[model samples]
Target: MSTTSTQPANSRSRVITASLVGTTIEFYDFYAYATAAVLVFPVLFFPSSDPTASLLASFAVFGAAMVARPIGAVIFGHFGDKYGRKATLVASLLTMGIATFLIGCLPTINQIGFWAPALLLVLRLAQGFALGGEWSGAALVATENAPAGKRAWYGTFPQLGAPLGFIIANGLFLLINFAMPADDPSQKSDAFLEWGWRVPFWFSAVMVIVGLWVRLKLVESDAFKKAEAKGTIRKLPVLEAFRTYWWQMILGTFLMLATYVLFYLMTNFTLTFGTKPQTLPEGGDPATFVPGQGFAYTDFVIMQIIGVVFFGIFTMVAGPLADRFGRRKTLIWVTSAIVLFGLTFSFFLMPRENPVGEGTYWMTLAFLIIGFTLMGLTFGPMGALLPELFPTNVRYTGSAIAYNVSSILGAALAPIIALALLSTGGGNPWLVGIYLSAMAVLTLIAALLMRETKDSDYTGDAGEASASHPAP
Candidate 1:
């Protein structure tokens, strides 16, 4: 097969569909866990001796997957570079689907003692491992088959999965949370904890069936086929990637800093912050007022669902914009905007004290809209930009390493770090904002350093892949 971007229309559509569906299912699984971590895990899994400690424990389980991502990248990248994108993609989807379904079946701390959290951690790691491999395969297939000026647009199909997954995950969790209500403030809601949370996890088994049906239909990326035909496949892509493309791996990880920081702060940190009882300021009496803003948890989830829908729309818009403005340039602008968003996060929307009026409601909406809009613009181009940094031979290994390592640095620990900061500052959000701003600066510098790869040739091999096969 020719590796030319001008493939048949039917194949192109199938490739794009495969990419979008697989990526969507992967993200949906992830975001669902994140939402649950804030709302359910603390109560169900950890020692409730201290609120902050339990919350930290929940986040640690969440971060466990991030820790596994780079390892998954190495393992899966080898097969993707040697076997084919389609097979690796299918396997990764099954890995995630099965892990998620199992998570639904696990017992809570009350039912199974320590085994509950231990089992949950294992499944979380599996989910992380599968996703580490999943995104790169989807991205590589889409871009490799796309026409020259259209790779960025094609790339967004996979990136678009984040917000689409976010909406579905948040929506389901929201509905589940609503199914059981807290009729008395003195007691917790066991209805949701007992059974409502399990519904989404079991549904993942069905989602896996759909994702596999679509992904299994995908034709291999033309670029990979071209390399295999020319006898240029490598057996040990991981070593080759490190030896030749270490700089790109490093820079790509740094370039993703702002995006990783922004999302965890938005979704995980905010939920924890909003729902945790607000500490009374010095000299204030608790007898006269409610602790925290008293914002409804389900209402906040609804707000997030609406915000994520726009997040998806802007991600779609970013595809065409990147094709026109240049990937590097567009990323630089979007990241710079994120810096401004970080600096103003508290001033414009979140109330420093109890929000007693309608004005605070509008401010809260403003905060989410601005943050997600910027998230959409910046995230859309990443799928195209990361793979473009490497040649076809090491593209899978290189992009996988860079993308997953950044997850460890940013998303993996973001909620934990933000919680510590919040606890230290007595619930002040400024520390978290500062952390987000610093990451945006790193992202800006990285964008400035990277070369524009929108027009790079994907059909060529990198200096004869050693051994016509690297060691497996």
Candidate 2:
């Protein structure tokens, strides 16, 4: 269990691969669902008289998954903290994979009536539940095995999964979109709605198999073994986490708030807004029209993919910066930039005189690149910062709770709120920008309150000192 400087090279490689691949698969499954929520589910599953109503209903199901995440965090965190990371990680990946595959095979509302959306919600919650455990475990696996002075750098490996997954999932959808027979290059073919959209969901099964294989090869980290040897493993880690580290939990949650808000806004809300028509259709009533910067779905997705490349790059860049400058200082600077970025949303996203023209397209693409860049800077450090807040004994529980709890406050509400704000602003994105700015301010406060955790001892456990009895 001891990590020496001369740990086997393959062992280090396996640790990075397992942690990265597991989260890559988990995020792929999640992103597949997210893309469908915007494109297919609103029409196929919700089917309301109003388009906005249908989209809202679809987003509601998406947000419902966030509601289940905290519960998942508690359940998975308990076993992860008590038993070990390996089995719990495998279980979470399997659960997420199965749920996503079944979603691909589901009957649409037209075929199954009310049962369609009902079944979708169940599977969505399962995905959320699985992910609740997946991230924290993966972060632990990477950081716990890190060499001296490189925990932050190692931590970025798992965080890389987000952009990697986004690219793969969205790229697959883009390919499928192009392959389907359609008169217009930008619009979805009827065939896509009926079947093409399901391919990404089913593809998750194959990715999960690879992830499981990698994870099964993992050994418990040195930190976990040390906790076990010292009899620091608790019978009830969740209770102990809340009892001892509640303040850290609160700080960690808010620290993640702006990142979640920005992420969902960039991926989910932007997709919805970008694809909406800039002008009313011929013979349509002006009173009922909602203006948007109408780009074709395919075009906008390509734009998003471009921006996500910056997301991936900055994520890696954040790790080294955090390692050098400290997590708190790096996050404070990045979060402040996010605040300024939020203020510019309207300038970038709003419709121009010619919404779909070449000039507007370039501006929107710039907006996406800048937003995703800031997202990367803020999101990358979380893998190290959150886990560093708690000792090894309760680290899994404490970090998972904070991470997923923030999901409820930020990811769960961001798209729904942004959409409503769009409606409130009459399709101008300024109100949505204000919402993001407000959340970033909260995150800034949390960052200000948090102590620098760059130098925290990863292998120590304060819980052991307080324990009346050790695990036998």
Candidate 3:
């Protein structure tokens, strides 16, 4: 702890808090757009004749940010590795905050037509760019500042942000939705479409203010500082990262794919699938009521919030499990479970072919609990695992690229794919489940190839300093 002049003995806790808070704000901004894509973007931004086409258009623009994430990783990673983690982190937060707040101010299709979606695509890119730099920096700060044998446990704090962000994002959406006339079938939703959805995006400004305050309070992380002191920091971390750890990046990308697939499927895709109005029955019992049709938006949010609670619980459990069982092994088991869960998604998410009314809501909640529990298991160890893949010098660049690459390949396209499959099958969750299972298997293989890294020395000069002081 003596390596720093400004920080006190509680530096580890401070670092964890800062990382968690910052990432929460980042994901909150992210899911806010995701929720809007389904609930409002189709009606507000992409006006279309066919309702399916409109939703798909909203999802395509939603994918734009995922595409931009790797680019953000490059820009932020260069500066983070070149200068310091603290500065880059603060910059990322401000960038996302500004972009998200502006999204609230943008006009809808009624006001601007084509330019509405065009401008939205641009801001979504900014959001992705900012987040590309965020998670890696946050993860590193927590793990680098952790105690000897508690990297996974400390790392969980930053990992904690995903579910926390889900809760906060949906919690706000649910509250705002409650205040509006979204559920009223009497054609009273003009206020909701016109102004209600924007409230969440506009609220991000206040969140960013608080996030920046916590992040600014943080000191530089010990791991990055140690490498810098020894003159081991690389001038070009991107090239060096690929040269030394290219294969690791590929494997890390796949390792994270299952988790990303798991989340986006349940959260984003389900938001769209569960909210549309029902049409002519394709081939079902005429008596069975189809779920997720019109005005079910708030109900789905409530279901997701319940799942978030379970995700939070298992996320805490996952950290300790990873610490004891080893990171690679923990990931492998979780990925396998994800595969099985994906295969069984139809049974869990919908008990009957056409479940109607309150029973359907209970079934949806059950499915979310099952899916999100797996999400937590696969996701919680990542803050420790990704940074362990490369040495301290190129850690930020390596992990950032790998994390966001999975975003592009898996999450960036999930809702679009899910909706496409549903539109083809006349709303079939089984096809979406099969898509998830395929990605999960790929992730399982990547986990198999990776070695346990919990024992690696992360201090300096290719090895840790021998047992200096225990964790704070």
Q: Tell me, by TM-score, which candidate is best.
A: 2
Model 1 TM-score, 2 decimals? 0.93
lDDT of 3: 0.81
Query: Which parts of model 3 have CA positions greater than 4 angstroms off?
Result: 1-10, 182-188, 281-295, 350-354, 461-472
Model 3 Cα shift for residue 322 (angstroms): 0.5
**Candidate order by decreasing lDDT:** 2, 1, 3
Candidate 2's TM-score reads 0.96
Give lDDT tens digits, candidate 1, residues 371-450: 88888898889889999988777788899999999999999989888877665555557778888999999999999999
lDDT of model 1 at position 46 = 90
Residue-level lDDT of model 2, residues 240-331, one tens digit each, is 88877899999999999999999999999999899888877666666656677888988999999999999999999999999999999999
* Clashing residue pairs, backbone N/CA/C < 3 A, model 1: 235-470, 236-470
Sort all candidates by TM-score, best to worst: 2, 1, 3
C-alpha lDDT of residue 163 in model 3: 89
lDDT of 3 by residue, 22-46 (tens): 9899989998998888777877888
What lDDT does candidate 3 reach at residue 114? 80
Q: What is the alpha-carbon lDDT for the whole of candidate 1?
A: 0.82
Q: Candidates 1 and 2: which is better by TM-score?
A: 2
Query: Which has the better TM-score: candidate 1, or candidate 3?
Result: 1
Model 2 lDDT-worst window of ten: 1-10
Clashing pairs in 2: none
